[model samples]
Target: MPEYNAPLRDLRFVLHEVFDAPGLWARLPALAETVDAATADAILEEAAKVTGGLIAPLNRSGDEEGAQWANGAVSTPRGFRQAYATYIEGGWVGLSGNPQYGGMGMPKMLAVQFEEMLYAAGSSFALYSALSSGACLAIDAHASETLKRTYLPPMYEGRWAGSMCLTEAHAGTDLGIIRTRAEPRADGSYAISGSKIFITGGEQDLTENIIHLVLAKLPDAPAGPKGISLFLVPKIKVGADGSLGERNAVSCGSIEHKMGIKASATCVMNFDGAEGYLIGEENKGLAAMFTMMNYERLSIGIQGIGCAEASYQNAVAYARERIQSRAPGGPQARDKAADPIIVHPDVRRMLLTMKAMTEGGRAFASYVGQQLDLSKFSEDPAEKQAAENLVALLTPIAKAFFTDTGLESTVHGQQVFGGHGYIREWGQEQLVRDVRIAQIYEGTNGIQALDLLGRKVVANGGAALRQFTGEIRAFAAADVPHREALLDAVQRLESTTDWLLQRASENPNEVGAASVEFLHLFGYVAYAWLWSRMARVAASKRAEDEAFYDAKQATADFYFRRLLPRILGLEASIRAGSDPLFGLAAEQF
Candidate 1:
């Protein structure tokens, strides 16, 4: 099995050096009293210890053992139970939750890095906490004050875990057709009866109670998504005094046998007359659930980063030790049978590709996290609105782009290991299998692309896009080496956005046809902008850390030279429109 060492140095470079996270935090009055650079650094160090030491050790073992179901209850892999205990004791579940509710209330900027570390160490183990965090966010945002007071503290403290119940046997993404029903009772609670499938942490042995944020249709509700409502259904009911009552009418039907993240309990949950309380306004469940969906989408995107980071680390270690043919120019190790594989040009290319993608993905995720913090904490209305707009425009891109690159990066890492990568013993194959799901879950990357192009861009008439590109244009105006290239990329993206908007109006089919490539093109340009920013920062700090800063410049150059050009092809394909895509009829297949 491969070992994991937290990318602490690079994380510090991104957090402190590039973003000046401490200064940003100081500016947000909400966080100024509680968090500073020193506190953030200290928190990150402790998080690194927990993830690297406790969680990373269980990754391979968890995948092998997986989660098992007996009778109606699910049990995680052996070490997971213990690791979860430690995770709870560390107060990690509430790392970015509301401080009034017994949470640390850390800013997203710092929490995001810790999140990447968690996924890097153990994604399956991380799901248990991840789902809880999303569910808590939804509850904190929309649930009643009584609900928050009773449930938030315990869930944040990790005494009770949480799950999101939206999918059913017949309904997956189309929640409008869901058969789940919630009938109101005289006591103000509702009787919830639904069967939810693919419910992560639905029935686990780790926590005493499981808080389920379920989506169902009310009796008097209208048709379709308009009628859907959210309810707080607990596995074990909670009484008025905040005491645990008898078990509710909820049970796990079975656990899914999936390709990866095997240790996470993905259950088919059956709720038969289960007691539940309404969360937000009736017929507004989808909106309320979005609070969780948005959070989980970003977290799932980071899962891609986590898996890629692990794969890259292992690939690098293997490349340094495995000997092969001599270098093209000359043998580095004269006395050995052959030089290490790292000396090979092809191998170096693969390593560099992985490095560029993973590091760029990290920066991209951090950029989004910063926007989220700004949206949440900034007092100025204009600043807050701008941040919110950017978040809306970029959320879909971050979710889709990160995962797509994440899967690609993992594959590249596996390729560096050759045939050994396909074998189970080396662990590279597992990384590939695990990272694949990130692209498919919490709304598939395809959905994300459509959301970006159709809803976010087209619906807003490109206002958010213009706002984002304006920032990039201003940054490119700075005295950076790649100023011209950066400015050119911004222009290309702006032109492409205009083309998409114009053509989409003429032919609605063009939107779906062009969305995936459009998102990818946008992603490439965004990463280029971020890399340019990092390069500028690195150049200024070259005197302080020569090797690190030099490496940053080299990677930025590699990305600009090799990867950023991908947007060219993407733009071409998008401009071709939907004619070829729709030419093949349904019967053709």
Candidate 2:
């Protein structure tokens, strides 16, 4: 197994140099006094030490042992409890949470990089806290002040973990048909009776109690998604004084045993007459749940970025050290029997593909994070609206595009290992399995593409997408290398957006049929914009750091030259219309 490093230099480059997070933080009065460049750097360095030294060692072992469910309770793999203790002790759970709730109040831009590191180190362990952070964000935003005071502190302290209960056996993506019931009780509280499946960290040994943000239908509610209501239910009841009371009726019926992330407990939770508190207004659960869902979406996107980073690191290590054949350019390794696999053209191609995609993905995720920070923290109303619009447009793309690229990158990483990648000893195969789930969960990539095209772009009349592309256009117009290529990509995205807007009015399937391709095209263009910006920055800094900046430039060149052309194929496919896709009848298959 390869050792996990945090890639601190790349993280810092994106944060301090590329995005100027410290300057942005200084402008936001909420974060002005709390975080600065030095403090952020120190925090990241400490996080690096913890994840790399402690959490990473258990990744393979935890996967090997998996989470055990002997009785109703679930137990995490060995070393996980101790690692989690250290994690909470470091106050890592509430890294970006509200300060009023014992959170550190870090900006999303900074928090996201740490999240990527965490996922890269150990995804199974990371899921436990990822769900907690998202739940806390939802409670802080939509829950009552009394509820927030009661629930937020312990969660931030890591004494209590959290989970989002949205999926059921019958209703995975379509929550309109869910059968969960939230009936009104005599005392004004509600009894939530439901069974939620695919609940991450729903039943765990690391925390004292599990706080679940559940979705159920009320007795007099309307039909479909509108009738649903969000509820806050806990495994152990808590008194008004925040003391733990008797156990609630919630229990884990069973834990899933399949695919990757075996160490993370995906449970079937049964809430039998369990007490739950309503969140937000009644009959508005879907809107309330999106608060957490959107946060989880971006976090899951970072999971993809994390996996890609880990895979690239391991593959490069293997490529440099594994000697298999002589170089095509005669005797490169004169002292050895054969040259290292790094000398081969195909191997280099795979490695570069991994590098370019991973790095481009890292930049793209950070850009989205920066937009989130601007949306949340900025005081100016217009600026906040603009930032929010961009976030709405880009969130789905980030979630889908990053994970899709991540799976592709991991496969390349696995390919680099050849036979060893297929085996269990090297641990490369586990990465392939673990990352596969990211694309499926947090709203599948197909659903994400629909969300991007149907809801964000077309529903909004392309305003949000235009705002995003406008920013890209301005950046491309700046004095940068490959300006023409960047402009062409942006034009392609704009024209494709127009085509979808026109074609969808005649045939609704046009949106669904063209969404994935449109998203990929947009993703390629977005990366092109970032690459051009980075290349300009690297060129200016080439005199200061010769090799580092040059390598950055070379990678940017590769991204533009090799990877950006994929957009052309995507554009062509999207313009081909939906006739071929939906031409078949229901009985044709």
Candidate 3:
């Protein structure tokens, strides 16, 4: 198995050049004092060391060992406990937590890069961190002040971890179908009774206690998603004095044996009359859960980016070393039996495709990160509103597009490895398996597509799309050297959006059928804008290092010339409408 290394140069470029993250952070009073350029660089450097040195080594072994279950107890692979200890001891779990709760309170923009590195090193290991942060974000945003005071500090300090219990056997995406019930007790708490399947980090030995954010229904609550309520059910109960008390009623019935990310335990949790406290108002669980869902959706997209980077690194290494037939021009390695595979055009195509998508995805993630920061920190109400709207519109795109590209990029990486890619030892197969979940979890990619078209686009009469397109147009209007490519991308995006709006109005099924492709089209154009911005910044720094700038420019050119052209095909598919998808009868087979 190949060792993982963070793409430090690409990360630095995205943070400093593509988005001017430091300048944005400087304007936010909450983050201005702690997250300067030097500090950010230092943090990235340390994160790189931890991820590459500590976590990367465990990727193959964790997959091989997987998680074991015995009599309701789940054990992680060897060194996992120690790695998690290092993670908590280093305070990484709370990198972006509230300062009042013992968190470092770093800006999300800077934290996002760290997140990418973690995912790249080991997707399985990264899940633990993501769940912890997401659960904390939910609790902080909606939980009562007393609950925050009691739970947030310990979670941030990593003395405890968190999990989300949402999916039941019958309820996956459709929360309204859940049968879990929460009976209100006389003491202001509730007794939650139900089972949650596919619960990540539901049971683990890494932390002292696991806090579960569960969704259940009250006896008097309304039906469907609206009737759901959020609860804080800890594995071990805590007293009013903040001391660890008796164990709660929640227990892991068993851990799932998954295809990938075997090291991260997905549990079937049995909440048998678990003592739970409501986090938000009664019958408002789904809305509260969205607080975590929204964060997890973007984080899952980051997971895709992470796995793609891992696959790319390994594939590039293999392509450089594996010798095959002679090059088109001549034998590049005369002493060897044949030229290295890297000399071949097809291999180069695969490698370049992976590089273009991976780099472009990084840039896009940073762009979204900046939007999240602006939404949280900007003082100007209009700026904040715009940022919020863009975040809302782009969230689905970020989640669906990045993961979709991630799977494509990883498969391309595997193709570059030929037979060795299929074998488990090379680690390529693990990348494919681990990335597959990103599309399914945090709401399936199909659902994300529906959200983008139905709710986000047509529901608001294209308000969000128009706002996003306006920003892209502004970027296109800037007098940059890649002005033509930027303008063309903006035009492509506008045309696609207009087409979807018009077509979906005529056919409701069109939105459902065309949603996924439209998202891809949107992603490709957004990435083009990101790459163009990166190229412009790299150009200014060419005097310091010409090769780096040249590589950036080449990748940007590759993205626009080779990758962005796919949008045309997707546009054609969307224009075809729902005929192929919905026209078939259920009994046709």
Question: How much lDDT does each candidate structure score?
Answer: 0.92, 0.91, 0.90
Write model 1 residue lDDT over 351-422, tens digit each, in one string.
888899889889988989999999999998999999999888888888899889998889988899999999
Q: Supply the TM-score for candidate 1.
A: 0.99
Off by over 4 Å in 3: none
Candidate 1 Cα misplacement greater than 4 A, ranges: none
Prediction 2 TM-score vs. true: 0.99
**Per-candidate clashes, comma-separated:** 0, 0, 0
For each candidate in turn, the TM-score is: 0.99, 0.99, 0.98
- C-alpha lDDT of residue 386 in model 2: 90
Which ten contiguous residues of candidate 1 have the minimum total lDDT?
476-485
- How far residue 449's Cα lies from its native spot in candidate 2, in Å, is 0.1
Structure candidate 3, residue pairs in collision: none
Residue-level lDDT of model 2, residues 49-90, one tens digit each, is 988999999999999999988779999999999989998999
Cα error, candidate 2, residue 34 (Å): 1.1
**Winner by lDDT between candidate 3 and candidate 1:** 1
